[model samples]
Target: MRTTLYGQFVAGTKTDEVKQIVDKFKQYNVKVILDYSMESDISTSITASNNVHKSSFNTELDESNTFKIYHPDERIFNTNMFNYIKNSNTSRELCGQSSFIAMKITALVRPLVLQKLNQFLESRITDHNLFDTIDSLLTTKNDFTHSLTPNELGEISNLLLRINRIIQTVKKNEGRIFIDAEQSYFQTAINKIVIHLQRLYNRNNLLVYNTYQCYKK
Candidate 1:
């Protein structure tokens, strides 16, 4: 079913297939914005209340029982993005122009982590220390602290590292990346990460672009 739909709308399923599609597009002076269409689902059981408890801030990333079990695909997002980068690079060389890739943050980070972070940001605390506070809470585990468990922290760290790698790859290939807007629940975290990437890569021109879904408005 998906194959039929992909054939109708999507470029292709594999790298070589997509390259062929891109080649055909180049014949018409068209460019491609490669995208990995994986989106995270909101788990009914996972909530901000379940992860956060108290106001204590010190935390660390390690293996622990308190961390939420992550979806298996979370580990595979980076691999998919890596493949996309490689394909985009090939497409660029084939067409002799800039290539673009679209990303959905939920594909890289778990929705639960984003929910907890959003709750933390919305809380009556200092906004300037947001990342620091999140970092401190993510690095340590204590009964007195209300923050992410060691395993969750590790997962978040891995997600951030993967995002950084994607940005680095795009920069290296002289390509551009655009982040897709997701549900409202995850937008804040998405925006934060996108802004960070934009600051780093969008120095002279817009190497990173973030989409805002107007239909939601």
Candidate 2:
């Protein structure tokens, strides 16, 4: 019960057969963090795309007929398929199974949306990069607004929905969601959207969590 670990000790670390562990921790009045160790479950990929892997990936896949040999980008979502994750995580969370979701804004929002928002943030009051540059981006469906190819556009759209769904889940269950940060080259871009989401969703409290990687110059 009285543990000692600096790093965030994930929930599953205690072990699935945790009746004794739970009882011991309860005696000590210890708090617990929800961390599902289903590393294989969420937005991850199965490596070794050989016949075995290919056959395995196809197992239980709904689109059996549509399945074909495709590149990784085509097969998987730019940041883990949203529909698959929504269904998977939703079920996992409901089972009192997984908690403490560590996700990325990049996984959900299109890079170009961040790019446009970052660009506007840098413009001076008179820098004349019309507000639409960023404003429309927020209002419009980011999935269809980018200059990427048709297939790329669809992939990007999946990410937007994935983000929306993730937030909806966090909001529904009052769960904590952490949005991890990246390099300085991306802070502004990440910040712009994160703040927007914060203001939109985090009015009462810090709903959209943003990580600041402080190792940069």
Candidate 3:
């Protein structure tokens, strides 16, 4: 049953299986866009401090249906993505062309952190010192009253490191990556991450592309 369901939509669940599928597509001159469909496990949560005002924004989610405030294990997601890129690179080497990998930023960073960061970015979008503000947030070890907690800041830094690793790996292997867009609520944060990556990787040409889901608008 599981095989029948996912087979229709996904390439494959295993690395070897997916690689075989990509190889088959190569025979038809069709390139593959590999995506790890684990982003649905990502969820939003409300801290105890925010519970007082949760009613105002409908921030409370069903506890049983959601993971913890932040997804406790990001390494699993990172490893999966890294392996996908490595495998895709190997396939590309055999095919002598670029293979695309799509990433959803929500899978790397918690939704709550993104929500807070997005709020900050939205309020300061037009500020002259916007990049400076981002730099400060990324480097600051202490939590300001209006800023993220120390733990959340650390997580964000770790996320950036992991993302940079993926970007560097793709660049080294002569491949490209696409950042997949999600709902409008999260688009600002997603765009910020993609822009950061573009500035780093899209130097000579457009190696990284951000998907614009026009249907949402």
Candidate 4:
């Protein structure tokens, strides 16, 4: 499957469930560098009732984000969902096919903790509402989020704590994790977090990998 990091890492999807995929690939007998389709967003609701949100985030892209009002078709990639997956399951623990069975982190965690963490991240550090950021473009809007100014430092503490937790978990597990490249708007902040995480977990081992995306003239 052409999975994103969100799917494979965050959602804890079953590699066993994709036995057909594994079998097909095994035919070549080469190797696999798998990516996941689920992200922290997958943590939202996996039950039958949550299919609406699942379908949208998992398969479809829409013009819903504040930035999309200007950069329509832009993908926000749902931080809450990504955070949900990262915080939910254990990289070290899980049982299934041996691909992950012969694995490392070998731990397990609930999805709720991740949901709470991302909620904290979404609110306190990354709390600005959609309308607030794009108030000028909005025709009819109440000024609830406007009064709150950005708290640069406070905005990062939630992320800082979360990143620390991720590094600790990954190191404790001996697993490799990757961070997808992001748009330039978030490059500075994301890079800072990655650097901090690398120092803590990957000083000796290459546990964390980052994608490099560039703009061409």
User: Model 4 off-target regions past 4 Å?
Assistant: 1-15, 26-152
Best by TM-score: 3
Candidate 3 clash pair list:
none
Candidate 3 Cα lDDT to native:
0.64
Candidate 3: where are CA atoms >4 Å away?
1-5, 40-71, 75-81, 84-95, 132-144
Model 3, 151: alpha-carbon shift in Å?
1.5
Model 4 Cα lDDT, one tens digit per residue, 1-217: 4455654433335635444455565678733333433333223323422433422332222334222111111132224323434432332333112122111110111122223323433444544343232212122223223422122122233334434455555555555666654434344334444555566666786877665667635
When summed lDDT is taken over every stretch of 10 residues in candidate 2, the lowest stretch is 36-45
Please count the clashing residue pairs in each candidate, in the order shown: 6, 0, 0, 17
User: Please, what is the whole-model Cα lDDT of each candidate in the order they appear?
Assistant: 0.65, 0.46, 0.64, 0.37
Q: Write the per-residue lDDT of candidate 1 for residues 56-139, one digit (tens) a residue.
A: 433432243332334443435555556656655765665454678887777766677777655654562455554443344454
- Off by more than 4 A, model 1: 2-4, 44-74, 124-145
Q: Estimate each model's TM-score.
A: 0.72, 0.50, 0.74, 0.42
On lDDT, the stronger of 1 and 4 is 1
How would the candidate models be sorted by TM-score, starting from the highest? 3, 1, 2, 4
lDDT of 3 by residue, 1-217 (tens): 5647778778766667777887888799888776666463224334423434422332222234332222344445456556656655764564454666777777677667777777766766776455543456575443333767655665576667667777777777677788898866678777887777788779897788888888753
Measured by TM-score, how close is model 3 to the native structure?
Answer: 0.74
For TM-score, candidate 1 versus 2, the one ahead is 1
TM-score of 2: 0.50
